[model samples]
Target: MTSSVRGAQLARLLGQWHALPGRHRRPDYAALAAAVRGLLSDGRLPLGVRLPAERELAEALGISRTTVSAAYRALRETAHLTSRRGAGSWTTLPQGHRVATSGLWAAGDDGDVIDLGVAASPAPDELIGAARAAADDLPRYLGSAGYHPTGLVELREAVADDYTARGVATSAEQILITAGTQQALDLVLRLSVPAGAPVLVESPTYPNALAALSARRARISTHGLDAATGWDGELLLGALRQGRPRVAYVIPEFQNPTGHLMDAALRERLVATAHTAGTELIVDESFVDLSLDGAEMPPPVAVFDRHSRVVSIGGMSKAYWGGLRIGWVRASAPLVQRLAAIRVGVDMASPVLEQLVAVRLLAQAPQIVAARRAQLRGRRDALLGALRDHLPEWTVTVPAGGVMLWAELDGPISSALSRAAEDVGVRLAPGPRFGLDGTLERFLRLPFALDEETLTEAVKRIASVRYDLDRGARPTWRAPAVIA
Candidate 1:
């Protein structure tokens, strides 16, 4: 059965909805249909969510039931909504339109396609040994209840010690192990910020973070990052001072997509400014250990935070393996307690075996970091060379670290290119997925985490599609033969 949204809740969510910004003198029904369609297209209204009944929604919005019925009819005709006699209408994107319009993409199921959308690599050989070791230690924990909301004590201590080694004095009480960085972010946002509160985020930031903030119905304010200069301190400070957001989500070290590392001085200033503005800063440092230059990096932002306003999230996804699914949040002890309580309602606790494996993996962090650095550096160089050779018109920055490159295309056809590339055995995330609203259409994120051969072949296919798009060829939208 499909979950249903209450009329009051749906009305609250639709409070910010407005007609599309155009000069067309459309009827009220068409305008309302377009507004809801925009929400569905951008994922604000998730698929399978049953909308409020026409009469109920009309009453809530102070509109006539006839208008609401017409709007529903329009949405139904366009396949954005499906209705049953007594069950009311539910939100959904037309089958073929889901992927491209939703701004999310994945590889094909057949193993014959290259997916440049996600910047993830395979787990290292050490994972097997770690898992085996964890199994050997599992018997000891069977004597007691395994539920640990705050995470295994051994893993917490390891994470705390890891922070201490990095120049930040931390204790186990200040750390809460999470399923992954994503969960850490979700927990923090839910506990610290209320719905409709203003939240600051970097433009063209991680798409998943944006989606999380959107899910909370937060008022998002963006501070743009310069591809050449990285983060703009003044602009960020101005937004903090003016917007006075309740939270600011940022990726400080080797930021996603762009891979721009925040300098130490600016990092300190940003934290101080946020403290003065009463903004809680959530810093994601998942890629901090993947520096390709092997240079000594700046300390974590938590080191510069004196007011307990910054919460740093660290994960093994990028450094070691995404499958590890282990991450931690370093904050004040009280904040950690609050997040743990909130997490109880979410997942109850992270898996015990994964926590055990994480402990062993933490012991071998130096080796893992070094290996990932070498592997990603080689792939980065290879992808750069391929792009320069095949798609010369696209301008891209050579990121010093991180697994992806944010490249600006010669034309604003990222969405079209992504749709067409799928037909040629390649899947790409359109640029607009990384930004708020429908911005960043002229850019694309190209991940180099795959094998060199796969990267080469993917780039070849992308180049062919790019050429076709440049020649005025449009994509023919159809359901994929296979979904992965």
Candidate 2:
């Protein structure tokens, strides 16, 4: 089951390959090789995916075949690519090279390193008491076989009740708990999206969702997002009607990276358009509970779904803690059954103790979320101030909620910035990682989930890296202690 990228697609992913930061205007084979290597390191170009042929890529990129050949040859020599005579070339990692796809490894291995790759924070203080309560509650279920694919009843009721409080009347039967939002998305995609089906997503949506769509071989359609303002209503409606995708994944509330919240009017129109297009909606509400601006939150998109066409996915990772590993999907009861049936074949059920902890956490969510928001507000401001002090040239959009800030750099050097930042003990989530086809190179997503002091230090290091990169000096690369 080898996935082969088309020449046009590869060209799109290699957007502005010639005009990389500190590189000359004229594209050389060395620059091309470096670009591909950067893609591989950042998990953009997954290993083992067959690359387009040199001639085909050359035609698509409007370059000579000789340059493409030399680039491919350089990649092959570095063990970043493998080739057979007729089967074509495929991407691969070098034998001893270790790339931290998630920044946790680098942070754990090096104390000085700051991981801005993930936008999650540590657990709230309420979690410790909840864990103790969960421990006490766990023994009651020990005698049974312990298999609840639709999730534990108490937790489901809690989630459904939370939705109900948010204006969507949800029943316990409509909830299916999974490991996290990622797992819930996977379950929904597994049951809903078929191979080669058209799937609409936001241009700079969640990168992992894009990876899942790619793995499913879905035909992806994207509508661009404005970080300052949310979605353009007319553009999105037009895309829905034209694309007519089988499924559309959207993050209406405090969207990841870009924290723009969707207004209720847009929600109604978008859901109406989806119904007219006969497309199902997968609404991600992972950041729903993290409103920092004190604005009254808009109603969940499900409020506009008259036909149960919208499936809402949420989790405890962002507002609660990533360690909880608790997330659930809110859909029609029948759809929940189908998703649960599919999920049973995959992982049976979420761990009971964790679900118990989530139930307790939900009961105390009000206090936890308020404190979390206050903490995040300070961190967000601190990060903003640091950015202003360290790098005044970059433009940043102030998000109403969510844990990360979307920034526009002065140049299309996000990938280069990431490469250089590693030397300064900082791991960054570059702009292109959130985009499709190597787009958004002029942007970056800086998470404010860390403490104010840490955020200040990370911004300082990043500013230093940016300075070195702008001066056309490459930072000295040092190997991280951890290989995994």
Candidate 3:
């Protein structure tokens, strides 16, 4: 038996069911069953969510109990719902359904397997030196309880100073340390947006962010971000005016996967728009430091925030080593305090040694950034060249800065291609993982964080897989859309 939802809750989740297309042409029970199927297929109704009892749901929807029973029976026939005598019905994917996984792909134990799924780089040698320095400096905190829920004072000040240098004046009091940008995003979304309230996001935004928002059950509103033109300002502004979402999450600088940087003028306009609509803006600047063009980057969007409506999240995972696991949230002091209090209920505090190492790493930002840019530039060039030489049919945009290339395939078969690649010891994240409604199937995010030899081999394997797929080879099994 799956977890059950109350009749009122199920009714709320099925908002505007009657407005679905073709309702007038079908019977009441069939239309209702079709609506449920659409919700399950599109991920609006998550797997294992027990539906309301027939009589209770009938009362809530103002329908006869027989209609509700018939609808449930219809769903049972389709295998979208399963129920036991005592246990109520729950939603599920039909057998043989192929959907994109909602999170990062896991690496298999095979050493020869190439993981193009995750965009992460190896730690620099400086990490060892910083760890040693942090170990030497760890004695100072030994006298205390060592559980600083907010963060170490020195690390907070360092983060503030870094932001200050970037033209956003920040203070230690306004910063809350998190495990990483993922946790920072999770905390901000949970604390700021109410369940069922509208929340705006970029359509082809980060996958993990979508997962976080979906987990919160926030009413998501999306505006498209073109790979060529970056964000559509008019579309976003219109959504702000009409949707009036409680929170707007954006990756303004060096956006993930797309690698398009949001201009400073557009940033100001977005901040102004969000402010006018009374919606708080959450700016994720995790990719800000990875610019490969050597051009002067714009200041954070928080610089344009006068109404305290912008909350910025910065992290070390992209620019520096992900092993440090240090990220921070910059907001008003009161909001910082609230997030910190919430943090206590989660993990209490981040690792003190990691905080200390992050403090040292902050002081070495210049050197670390230079080295990262050089390595990433080389890898990016190599991958682009290999793709041009091997898979010329795929169109790719060279991101000015960032770890991945968003490539458009010849057809909407990214899921099928990924499944085929897995058979050849290559893993990929299909395009639908980054969008709603199972869209963007023609795109794939290819990471350039690996060595040239590894990347070349991976692309060669992918090409081979594509060949097999084109020749009518079928995948034996399907990857689950939601991984454990």
What local distance difference test score does each model get? 0.82, 0.88, 0.82
**TM-score, per-candidate, Cα-based:** 0.83, 0.93, 0.81
Candidate 3: misplaced stretches above 4 Å?
A: 1-108, 477-484
* Candidate closest to the true structure, highest lDDT: 2
**Runs in model 2 with CA error above 4 Å?**
1-7, 25-27, 50-56, 76-79, 82-90, 102-110, 474-484
Better of 1 and 2 by lDDT: 2
Error of model 3, residue 108, in angstroms: 5.8
Tens-digit lDDT track of model 3 for 1-484 = 4567777766765555564334455678986786566445334457888888899999988889999999999888767789889877888655645333321122332466687878889998799999999999999999988899889989999999988998988999999999999999999988987788799999798988988988899989898989777898888889998888999999978787788888888898999999999999999988888989888898789999999999999899999988788999999999999999889999999999999999988899999999999999999999999899889999987899989999999876666577567667787887766776566768899989999999998999988888775565523433434434
Model 2 pairs whose backbones collide = none
Error of 2 at 180 (Å): 0.7
